[model samples]
Target: MLGDSAYKLALETKRTQAHLPMYNEALVHHLCRETRHIMGELETLLQSLETIRDEPDADTRSVAAQLAVKHATVKRNKRCLLAYQAQRLRFLQNVFWQVGGVPEEIKPQLSPAELDFFSGYALAVNTYKAPFIDLDLTVSDLPPKDLYIEVRVLQDCGEVQLENGSLLLSKNSQHHVKRTDVDHLVSRGLLQHIDG
Candidate 1:
């Protein structure tokens, strides 16, 4: 019962490996409450142990065993909480790298703290990339076979300025552009690459 909430959080984290699940605020609170309760119990046991430290008839071993168990429970709960949060942070970082920013659909599912982290991460990445104006770190790892690729606009993005010239992007319109120019848009789902 003491570690049930933490166990549930661990299971939830494992179940949603492919995508992010909604933040489980209620379960987290419950786990925190459980930890606090255990800590209080632990403190009382400690005081009792201190009082019975020199008493010959007192069963000090039993109190010491209880304290150990409670201490272990507290450590387990802390670990589970940290693991759940760390997993979520890693997932958010991956999503940021994939999309250049958090997608609108995923925004509603993130906690406020996560959203703040995302914003901060985006800023940090941009700062890290500031010097490499010609390179995009968010693009695919595989090297491109061609410099020019045809892309179909998935939505009206208005006019976009490129290295060579400006192009009017309208829904259902196709344009042959440099791969580097549209990689970000493609990742954002505003355009689709056409294979030749």
Candidate 2:
């Protein structure tokens, strides 16, 4: 029997040896070799049997037979392209999913007019721009208790009224800004019209 310390050291050596980078590298090399072997078999089957096509030849028939065999062999693999498609869709859905549910991905390019239209809205939300006034800005996470609710959104060309029920935005505290005033503000390039 070895001494306890020596046995303990030996066990630790074995454990350490198993986890070495060299061991992992070897495993990676082994996997690469296996994959190459499998691909080689597939390549053999897929290689054109008819190096030159002519009127019906034995070579063409041989190639078709080889392909049929390979197809059967490939069926035994862990599914195929459709399986990959399913996995890909799942990944994209996971990334874009939010509490309000799925939103469409924005396209890479928008028309210049659309771009111009959106620039103000983007500036409003992202930065405190002119006419991007937060009339009812609050810290309280409460919905409007009053019967009416109004929100201002900027649009291209001019700003518009976004309201529902009774109340409009508290114009300088007491009343709502008049519809004409809102449109004028929008027309003057001071504000983009809000859409409902």
Candidate 3:
């Protein structure tokens, strides 16, 4: 029962393989409280052990064993918390690179700290790619077979400027545009690619 909260956090992390689950704020808070309580108990045990240091009795051994268990529990809880956060951060980073930015649907599920991290990461990536304005580093490395591709607008994107001209993307409207021109839109989920 002492480490049940940490175990639950581990299980929740394990369940999130492909997509991010909603932030478990309640469980995380509970685990933190549990760790604090255990730490207080550990401190009390330490003082008791010190008081009875010269006695060398069975009670001293019992208190020492309890202190060891409490210390182990604290370590386990800390590890679980760190692992869960690390996994979530890694997933967020992948989403940033794959989607070109964080989607609105995924934003609600992220914690405030995570949202800040995502924003900072996006800014860093944009800054890194600033010099190569003509090239899209986010697109696939393989060469395209065709210069242009067909895409259907899933949402209204207003007017998007291209090298030659601009196109008005309306909901449910289809267009034949250069693949490079709409690759960012496709990654953002505003347009869907169609094989022509």
Best-matching candidate per TM-score = 1
Tens-digit lDDT string for candidate 2 (107-135) = 23223433343454444534543455644
lDDT of 2 at 62: 64
For residues 93-179, write the lDDT of model 3, one tens digit per residue. 888767888889898999999999999988998999999879787876678889999999999999999878999999999999999
What's the lDDT for all of these models?
A: 0.91, 0.38, 0.91
What's the CA error at residue 15 for candidate 2, in Å? 36
In candidate 3, stretches whose alpha carbon ends up further than 4 angstroms from where it belongs are 56-60, 141-150, 156-159, 167-177
Better of 2 and 3 by lDDT: 3
Predicted structure 1: lDDT: 0.91
What lDDT is obtained when candidate 3 is compared to the true structure? 0.91
RMSD to native, candidate 1: 2.1
TM-score of each: 0.87, 0.23, 0.78
> Residue 80's C-alpha lDDT in candidate 3?
98
Alpha-carbon runs more than 4 Å astray in model 1: none
